[model samples]
Target: MNKIKNIGIGLLAVVALSMGSCSKDFLDEELTTKYSTEYFETAEGLEALTVSLYGNIRWHFGYEWAYGITLYGTDEFTNANDLTNEMWNTYDSRLGPIGATTSTGAANGNATSPNALWNEMYYGIASCNTIIANADKIDDEDVRNRCLAHAYFLRGYNYYRLTAQYGGVVLQTEPASGVVRNFTRSTEEECWAQVISDLRNAYDYFEGEVYTYGKGITWTKATAAHFLAKALLFRASERCDDWNSSYKQSDLEEAIDACSYAITARGGKLTDNYSDLYANWTGVDCDIEQLDEILMAAGHNADSSTSGRFGNRTYNYFTPQFSNFSGSWVKRGVWIGGMDFQRCRPTEYSYEVYDHVNDARMWKTFKTVYGVNNVADATAGIEAGDPGIVMILNTKDDHTYDSYTFGASKQAPNWTDDAGRLPEWTVGSRQTETSGSLTAETGQWVPNSLVLYQNGEYVASSFTSQPICNFFAGINKTDDGSRTAEKGDAHRDVTMARLAETFLVRAECYVRLGNYSSAMADINVVRARAEWKSGENRSYYSDGSQAFENNSLNTGSSAEKYIYSNLNMNTYYLSNPDLEVTTEASSLELTSFPSVLPDEDEAIMTAIGASSDYERALNFILDERSRELLGEWQRWETLSRTGTLITRAKAFNAEAAPNITAGKHELRPIPQTFIDGLLNDDGSNLTEAQKEAWQNPGY
Candidate 1:
């Protein structure tokens, strides 16, 4: 095995191991190889064992699992054409169910068996169990408990993940012994009970111990409670079907207590700006765990090797196709990393989640515009007062190929172009909105080209619509050569858990508990942080309407057709030193967004008849989660957990809308390989009926 250098930043210790077979022999080889169980008792051995748990086993969450499975097949994102994992986004039955992955390769468009994720978690559990078993031989008390804490957290976290996805699993509490290992699928009740028991043990290990943190993303008491709280809450939700019990009140109260404790006692706080969450990734923030806001994260490094070097793969998959941008485009690295291989595009419903005019989260969570970086590259004769200087443009599909609409630019040309990185912006003519009239009113031209005028206004000049994953939020540029959409080896570490979500979690619990006022208070904290400061919201219309409807709002295709817009910045138009001379009001035609949703987005929520606080609170939390957590993973699971998978997927995800069904879609079938491999008590192969019993219903 190769050596694994421990990275202190973000608790991302990459584990190195030799490749082994997929059968039982592979397990024996890994557990009894170069380092034996005795190695775990020694100081160096114990440290190595703890670090290994965070290694390759964690890759499932880091690379494909989070990107292809967790984030897709939900309401927010739709599959790009030929996105082989289209089966996931479309719920294609040809996909595997409780067996080895179909010949198509990736289980659902990702990689192998249901056992792939299962193997990832259980492998970690095996190592953790080994550490827990040997902790008694350690000489140092603190080190011993700390080691145990790490193992317990890893096991609990994995088990919780398993129980959440597959109703039950073969719960292995001890280390795998030999080539021939015996295992049985535990009940959902048993699995969750074990998860809670393990986490409680971890938290109790250092009860009252002042929460200390280190470089890599460490499993802390708060981390334990954080996940424990989420698990408890998921169980209490309506989706936890065929549940072991029926006490929603007690289960919810227990969940609420866990959440409240996690919020207050955990010592994490929300990052000041939501955009900062994705910026400066890959252990850039060494003390990320120390901050009260982030309890945990899937650790990663700048290393992007297919053979064991850990890297954040989601950063690569989520980017859109903005590489054709040649002239004067400023500061968009995420788009140019490679081909605009749009894996998952936002659904029409997703675009509506944002209050584009007032909420900064929309821009922070997505990159709507790229500004002119080079003065020489700016279109020849382009003037400061160009119509769409800072706006995004799209070809109106409702009209001819040459016809287009100019959206109000989101960024003002305010910043200086320092070394070709600043002074850019985009307008809002493109987004997926399903209202048939809305769709008819806005679209880009074919052959996909944006038109620039002598005055610098931008407009699309084609009939074909661009791919939907064409707009992404993260811009962490990868190595110039590693630019494939399927392999975005962008070296950045994104947030998996932060305090903002915990607040939303608490708000969700409060709503379930009928604590509307407390729920509102919890929800308001997140809102106030995202609340529009005076200068941040840019309004484009002299019409004084709070709403910024699409081109349909215009009476004719005259010169004034697509002119209403806004930018929240006061000096947003100052791209060059000379443009500063113009008044901000003179550029009023360039701004369209900047309105507060003070009444819980009532205008839009009411339009949909979401009138009651109960109804609106759920919508508020759902929207807030998407606004804050989109593309950061956890979409499909959240919808599934809330029992809204079908309704939401049908409403938003265009590709999956026609195919998704609640019956078997909520739970992915157990990997078939594991089912066939199941052995009877007498060492004989289990019959097909026996294997069937181990699978989820319908699969």
Candidate 2:
């Protein structure tokens, strides 16, 4: 971060660089000329600045910081066992006002610090201020209005995030041209009011018209309305209890109305298939930048040349170390999914919230199978296409296999029943080992299996290795197999706002308004999309099939390919007997509030002490949000706004539960650099007590 006399000055220094026209990359812009006030007053300079704001949007969604700030320390995710970025997830004494100074320091530096986000967002605000102040220089009315609209939306978007993370930060709407240190905090209410006002201005300028540039990555009327609804929802939430009583009802109504414009009025219908929204393969049909459901995204190009320094690294997190297993059957980089960064592992609560039996999302969103990739494993009758290890996410005893014969010869006698069995080895108990002939045979069944984990517990295995961070379930949504290199640029655009979240936002409003039936109706709309339709192949998955097809480039590789190329892949189970009761759409819908939370979910709600009906309803919405939007960067704000951060963290997040405090942990401490660089508004530096007073309570 650039040190300055004040925080605003540090933010303004980057405004000149952002006034350049965009290059081939949507996020790459270089300053071509020296800074000048007169140059920015020109039409070309102003338009160029407006274009740069699109690139600036990438900072919020592109890198590891995206997950660190939102997903970490929340119930949806915890640090992997092997992960070093523990400050954010653990919320220990290290998560202080100074912020993380390096990747492996006390914390994870900018990735997990409020410091970097604070500076970058204010820099963006400074840029937006420059554009909004000078966009009038453009003579064409249409261009001028467009520039203003973009500026307003970007400003509101940045402030919305800042306010959500650190309540009532120094609100600056004007561009700071020089160093100064007279800064003070505004009330949380004032910050939200300014954000709402800016968004409304952008909405009005759009005039219900939708314009998309850089594919579907740019802002539109729908995007403005969606965020407006979200901001209103935040203000209407319990976090605003001290000052929200007078306007809570109106804010909820307005939020619902804004959602109506974004969802129904403006062509904001969801994609027919949930897989379509996150088509991660490199097929021609995998284009997702212009999908109808995505209101806005952070765009990245397929061509790596223009993908900027860090091109959408959101794909690199949330993965387990599948390549580091005990057996020789699995290898790294041969498959299309990302490298095993293992920074954002899902919590036990994250997996339990899903309606695993009826919802297709559990099967669609998580990868539960790893195919044999090593050539040497072929001798065990486990060819490259064979299912190496299958994880059945069930707790029922009937779903398990009775016995297994491990390290046995090829001529092993009857490794359990051979008739009417599934495609591969099943998930079951190890009751007995069968006697077999000592000699091996060609093209005969043999065992060289790795351990298998079922429902976060190690149920059975051929290898004696213990299951830890290396065997947890992986989220399939950020799976990017299309990259040419192990750490290459990801082509998929980072989804920001989509129709699914819009529906959930409305459902939450109804819940707060005491309209349980209406809330369920809205909630069911998203759940219905998550349901597995009748007669659909249960074993197919889109990403897996594409990965297998890609693997076929190696000659004679026997990867399993899905028969239906058009439809995405499903769970590989042929006849999952336990899930038969609720495998279709109707079975997935909730009839009313408290419609039976899963066992783990019910336990968390209990720990949170939701004694009242409204309290339980809010907790239910939080669970639903995790099920639908786990790794999408929404958890922290959702928890914070509902004032459930402390309770939920205590209930579900093991790492953060013991260390997080109620009042202090709700909002991040204001960055220490910002606090240290301030003056007392009278040409004198702030005293130690003054600095302490300026920071958030407890930190």
Candidate 3:
């Protein structure tokens, strides 16, 4: 028998009593302790342990790039022409070609890199597991519970990210307890169950207001509920194959319930001015009052250490110069231009969705250089009458200038002679006239046409010069000179889980259940918000017909042509009233017209109110989701979950196969190293089933 010490080390250190080995009745002997699960006992110790869990939230370069690529790199949008490397390649929808080099999956040979995103997610899960296991031992209940809730939230979030990418993953709730830790992958249902349980637990512990870092604002129970609701909604959608097999209406009901809870609990309402939400990168001037819509955000600051510099760089890569910090370069002699990489360009499909005039979001999101800059200024010095010259002063004098053809008439303005003539000389003319040339001892002389002049003297001119104009018209710029701007900071925090989404979701549910009128009412709520005017306040069409009334334009051959054309005709018509139905315009035309497509409007309304309304509602929700959540990191998963990757592939004209075949590509491939290194030599003792199951479709 070993005697226990009276000194308090909590329950961590205890003596084990042996039955047969003891020689004396009350033998007292201290045996060296090998392993104990009771290491975290004190409040301070537990707090430190909990704080360590946050280290799991890392911002890896590859992970960030992948997330952005999977969403913005596809055909739905195009990269700005100037963006290059992985971004440009990906945006071209050459995934097989480029993903081979850039993607973290099996397409590349780097399926073994430790920094592969799969490893990061698992590592994050492990940290959460540690917090979950140790938090309960803390002396302070509040601290323990709070820490535990955060752990659960983080764990759920990580799992959500993982499951979204890899389908079902093994649910590990604790740290490795033995020399070997191996488990098979759980079913999608099982994984979602765990996620729901974790989120529910988190809700219980962190439902009340909790302060967030930087913003110092409290995330209420409503926020947690909103997150949970979004998760449930995604599950209900069952876009992922694993979940698709077992999707149920009950899941949608649960999602709706969660969203409703968030709305009611938080006194929920959409922020009145969506633009104000993202007006600044730092949260300094953000209206906390509008935070009800924003469930959570990865915070950023201008301070060096905390800023998301990479995110900012990525944003600058995609957005135009005028809408970003590069715009400030107008004051600097250096004029900024876009990458022209086509990686960040919005697709013709995406641009059409916006009701440009009424939607404030459109202007804030995109900048037509033609609209913002003086086209005359963009092609400034090259045009006739411009006093400036677009001469490239290079280090070495090895540049040449050629005469402009009739079609290419724009050229840099000729430099003035010593006499200070405005137009020094005309094209092809080298003679120095009295009025336009310098009068010197050696007769009239023109300033050296080949040399670049700064103040008045000739500087070296050696660099090549082309027309100083942007190929594409619109460009984005930073709000200020802040290079640390994030795309999230540029737009209104118009959340995806808004009241409109909920209504759409409910309408979808009702449609699925064949409840058309109920779904119609729900959808109408959203349309009403847009001010279409109903009943007594209803507006009529130009033909004195009610806007919603049926007509040949609404139900005939024109409707089919309109649907088939799908040329963003709405936006085109809005921007150009003179746009002939047959002829496409050379440039974007901004107009104020009243042209609305009856088919699309009727289809959307019918879908929202159809007997098969749920199906129609689903399509409508997805379409709207694409429109509303352009840069919100929703598209990839939405397409993946709904099995719409094929549709997207066709739309984007990607090199990928146009069918959603069941294979490794659907779920991302598990890194090969994880399989080789993390398993036993014989592979008999490892979680082989889980490992195999988690591999993506195309891998």
Model 1 has an lDDT value of 0.51
**Local error of candidate 2 at 42, Å?**
1.8
TM-score of each: 0.71, 0.84, 0.61
* Stretches > 4 Å off in candidate 2: 1-13, 16-37, 101-111, 280-286, 303-306, 376-379, 396-468, 544-586, 594-604
Instruction: Output the TM-score of candidate 3.
Output: 0.61
Which candidate, 2 or 3, would have the higher TM-score against the true structure?
2
Error of 2 at 225 (Å): 0.8
Judged by whole-model lDDT over C-alpha atoms, candidate 2 comes out at 0.66
lDDT of 1 by residue, 419-445 (tens): 212223332332211111111122221
Q: Which stretches of candidate 1 lie over 4 Å from their true place?
A: 1-33, 41-44, 98-113, 207-214, 244-247, 266-269, 280-290, 303-309, 324-339, 371-488, 534-616
lDDT of 3 by residue, 281-351 (tens): 22222353235555654323333323332222333334332322211111110012222223344543454
Count of clashing residue pairs in every prediction: 52, 12, 50
Give residue 387's error in model 1 in angstroms: 13
Candidate No. with top TM-score: 2
The positional error of residue 396 in candidate 1, measured at the CA in angstroms, is 14
